[model samples]
Target: MMDGSMFIDEWHPSDHYMSEDLTRPARHRTRTQSPPRYYYIDFGISRKYDASNTNPLELPIYGGDKEVPEFKEDYSKPWNPFPTDVWYLGRAIQETFLDRYTGVEFLSGLVSDMMHSDPAQRPNMDEVFSQFQVLRQGFSSCKLRSRVAHDEKRSVFHFLLHWARRIQYIVRRIPPTHTSLA
Candidate 1:
């Protein structure tokens, strides 16, 4: 299904941002060191009319031309708008590329960093690429995750990850080993 990125048929001059790629797909394409495209702006009245709802999923729209609080001002309960309520960038990208690729771990953290409450703290495209490189390298073997035992073993990759996580959880809950020994 087409999302707000493609759903948008119109673009205000002010709403437009510099495109680093021509096909537009490349504009948000995943670089070797950077992350994939992740647009989280809300489109406005047009999307509302299309969806029959006031909350538009396009971030560029809602937060761009239309201010969040001002948009909600006329309503009884005024509140700032969140892109998640209308759409999820992380899930959207995951679905878009589900059949195309594997190892989507970077997306989760990328989305978190991009959707930080403070835009100032958000990573720029270059920084995103740098961090993405590290994350991608860190989980490079995720796709190769598997195990075998006597030619009859379920994938211990997932199982081991789950178990390891539980161990870490327990370790965190327990006091430091050195401290206990001391």
Candidate 2:
């Protein structure tokens, strides 16, 4: 099942006890330890549907991210929560990552589609995931591992240092992104 309240803050790593092995410091963890898992919270405004039900609709319940375009204009009207969920996730990524870092411009297209003004025009979560997988597969390891430099200005020394670290990571054969680990 998908979350109805899909704001970024609603997702969190499970409590320490629930994921003790994965939560432990790297030095303390064993090679066989499972990857960390995240859980969704604050389901007070969430909804559930049967597998047969495809086009479920609901009146808006404002979430932590209140910038949903449809809701901003007229939230009283019932609409598909699925597309709004897509907007929540897309806006979250745009604000949390795209706006704050570099080297992830590949996501701009997908994010733009997810945040389309017309909710009906937005791709559903499944499509989003599928599109993201395609994007992820297209990136070379080095490109994926390239330092996601902050959007802020930095000194030449810092820029050189970043390249140096990139070379070091390549030499050490470190994996670019952690999603593959999961």
Candidate 3:
């Protein structure tokens, strides 16, 4: 399921939050056999280029969070936004999952490759997917899955705690006169 406010030209404050959501456990669906794949949505500022064109134009438009280093005004030439997307995804993975979790060294390495400062050095989506396939095979039926499961359980506990506090706050706001049944 999609979440977050959709912003076209305006800067979305929840960009990073939505990015983190990608790493969370997917909603279970009985009809679906494969795992959920996250996709970039709300491309309000997205531009279309000719199929024959390989080079991305240096547009003045700066979209999403300003975390992308290449988008800095000082950069001499315009670089491809495709690589910028790769960097953002890498950063999201690092900030949302790897830095907070344990036993995902291989995944961290892959993210590092994507977040490399040099846009040219970053792997395309195909290469990234292939690498993920290889790395995932190695981690399959191992400690990584257990670690993720533990993290999920911890997240659920924390979520419940947060909501409990909110509920307590709402309950405290009610007047004492309302306690008696009519």
Best by TM-score: 2
What residue pairs are clashing in model 2? Answer: none
Candidate 1 TM-score to native: 0.28
Off by over 4 Å in 2: 1-40, 179-182
Clashes of each: 12, 0, 0
Q: What's each prediction's TM-score?
A: 0.28, 0.70, 0.57
The full ranking of all candidates by TM-score, starting with the best, is 2, 3, 1
Q: Runs in model 3 with CA error above 4 Å?
A: 1-37, 73-76, 149-182
Q: lDDT at 32 for candidate 1?
A: 16
Cα lDDT, all candidates = 0.40, 0.72, 0.60
lDDT by residue (32-139, candidate 3, tens digit) is 122333466777887888877766766545765686767665655667777877888898888777877655666888998998878889998778888887775565
Cα lDDT tens digits, model 1, 1-182, are 21324322333333333233322422221121122234445444433334345343333334333322234344443332334332233335444543244444446667566545443455655566677566645642323231212222336675686456445545666321212111
Worst 10 residues of 1 by lDDT: 26-35
